[model samples]
Target: MAEALQPGDPAAIGPFRLTARLGAGGMGQVFLGESASGRRVAVKQVRPEIARDPGFRKRFRREVDLAMKAGGFWTAPVVAADPDAESPWVASQYVPGPALDEHIAAQGPMDEAAVRRLGAGLAEALDSFHRIGLVHRDLKPSNILLLDDGPRVIDFGISKAMEDGGGSALTSTGMVVGTPGFMSPEQALGAAVGPASDIFSLASVLVFAATGEPPFGHGASHALLFRVVHAPPRLDGVPPGLVTTLDKCLSKASEGRPSAHEVGAMLTETAAPAAGRPAAEVDAGGIPFDVRAPSPAPESAPTAPNPRAAGAPAQGTYIAPARRVPPPPPAVAPRIPVTPSAVHEFAVQDGGPAVFRRRIRKSALWTALITAVLCTSTALIGQLLAGVFLSVIAILVGFLPRLVGALPLLVRSSLRIDARVLQMRLGGTAFTVTWQDVALVSVSRTGNTLRLVVVLHSDAKRPVPAPLRRPGADDDREAEFLLISWNDQAVTSRAARLHATLAAAAGPAYRPPVRG
Candidate 1:
């Protein structure tokens, strides 16, 4: 969906220079951009008026945070953002692929196996978002990119953050934020949208992918919304393998829908033996998440075999059965019960309460042991020097308080998120920051290590000491505002868990940590 940049587009926003227009949405224009160093990105700049609104800027900030968490192999990850700019803009990794709508229009509907792969990938993307307490209220073909590998979910433009009850938190008064035909029943009714609404939309997308048509058939906005809320989805052309899952997802009652994790599992189980599945003769088919199949060479000679050949059937040509026999259960036949799957059933965080602890310094104990051993050796070797042994004992004993204090058991570097405040204990000192002062918690990459940082709102009355603070402050004075400092050794490995726990704890204030 790349188009030439229009005349009015800015040459650059922050460090990114605009190259081409990606697309436009209700929030703003998205452009293809490149940094001075040649890193490509999709930079979305908010409309001037929208950026001027305080509430919209606040929600834009939330969008940056949610988009950050909407990461996996299945979705574009956020790279950098400036939500406070005059015309706030955010950038994400650029994905080179045609949007799903364009792909369908150029080619045709995806066959069964291809649709299964797309469904699985989309489901996993939703799983990642849902796990982090985020929802893509606007799941549609346009927001999905069909690549040779799989589909990529883009655009968090109007995605709303879910609160304690899993309800939308950023919807404007009298404004519904979703594509009409793809939105859920509750969304159409202006109800509190949640993860289930996304599931409904996901199914609608799958139906579109399978049939080259919207599930309810598209038309006027109000009419589409009404059909979505009142009528059952038109799954007439959906592959048998996907029909039942789509039906469940398109349920009128959101509670009756399957979780993203479950949907992914079901698709994998329901698809035919992947080995026997034919490669897409079409451009949009043949992707298997992990790899892409080669496109078959076109035949120029008249002697080439064809499914519609007058004498013989072609490679992918379907031949009808002579009898009006009962078709073996459609790919989506309910008879194929979905049993539990270890690989498919993944654990996702749903804003549940969790205690996040700062990493313990494992080397502290070994360092203390080595120091004690070295001291004992020095004391023994210099026994004849009279005061040497006593001096060594005094030196080692004198350092006991410092050594013991650094022990993991004694050192207090941890933060607890309460309903009203964030309680932090660092360097044996305790302090509390009200929820209003804290803006977000993110895990960022710096060199080889990744660490967590707590960002405070700019308007906070008592700002925490930052790296930009005045130089020359003593250790004690510095430790007072140590809201975001640590060398979390295990942070790189436990990133997903840490991200979910911190995101849930931080709520709307959470930001996606930077990734390389």
Candidate 2:
């Protein structure tokens, strides 16, 4: 049993004065406190059960030591602590903001762009911690604060720091240190965790933000552990752009995940659209990673020199004639699926923006020929008795090529994405967006569903049109979007890869890739 902290009476620990109790948890009680200079802080005191364990105190002491050393935009700095005292306490800067849980509960789920920014920020924060050889074992929504300025991550190192210091683990012998719903599979199985474990926890936090629920729902801790270890996350409503990042992060094997920096880099690319194009589209539901290529920009527009190319390849630059075309008409956001096939080359057309067309390979032509021949023969046999049938068959033969060419254009143009000079063919029509045009990309999971979204470029005269099937018909349209009812994780993973590629292409303009 732990002694209760009373309100009103100040409890002095070392140089700080405890003012009021903040809250209590399985490990300890947190109190609102102040320093001699009146700086406010949140102080955590070890409970009697933990204090008797000697090892727990050491871990808390180590955490205090580490928090003092780790400082940045995301983590709360440590001010004072007393690990050797009768009741060990750790004090850190008091951040004024609602916990992520409360903020989402009060404000509703965040928009797609905001979630991407959050992921980038958190990943960068964790990267800083990992740089100094520290890992936060217990990362949860409650530990994250949505401050007026931005998000801040708290509870650094205390749980893991304790175990690192040869202290007792949060769980009983053979137990793990993380919360039931958010812990990685390895952590749940009493396996060793490194920086990858923190990445897993980060993905779990994103799940909560996107859908307001953890991947593993409330239940017995043991049951939750079993689920984390054996079953896939129930991602019923997550955005598609985010699925890949979250999936890789939540991989059961540590080796399967990327580092926190890699995740941050991808989110950063999604936040900032390349020049002259729109970012991905996002809505209340989720984020989309639809990268559409813009019309061929005028050749007179000076191309920025590639810094990477300076030292490596000596490929000659090709310059096309310049023409002052009218400002591009409102673009259409396409719902593209990121596929391994020649999506990149598909965005380019011979006529540039004047006439939108995709270059088909010989193989595609052969396949289309076989399909049309089969269809034409069937139609001729069925309608042979009608005089108009011959005319219709002749017309069909003439129009078959046009139909084949137009079908893919109509379908794919809607799913295109272009980040400035870096054109990406997502699906449907190939999209071309300048690097400066993209705003953000996000990933989320709800139950077993995953979603990804890209916020297109802001500051446009009119919103871009959604991808549509009928010519000149605007009402029935697909929003600038990407959807993968299944394998959504693969999409997010591909977006993350593209993000890295675009960021490298973007240079300094990429600017701290993640959003708040």
- The TM-score of candidate 1 is 0.54
Maximum-lDDT candidate: 1
lDDT of 2 by residue, 158-265 (tens): 446423634255554544667878888778767767789899889988887776668765544544565576557755456777787788888878899889999987
lDDT of 2 at 340: 32
Each candidate: RMSD: 22.0, 24.5
Model 1 agreement with the true structure over 20-128: per-residue lDDT tens digits: 9988875789999999999999998887866665577666687678778677778989999998888888898998877888766655566667677788889988999
Error of 2 at 163 (Å): 10
Model 2 TM-score (2 dp): 0.51
Candidate 2: where is the Cα deviation over 4 Å?
1-10, 161-172, 272-516
Compute each candidate's TM-score over C-alphas.
Answer: 0.54, 0.51
List per-prediction Cα lDDT, in the order shown: 0.65, 0.58
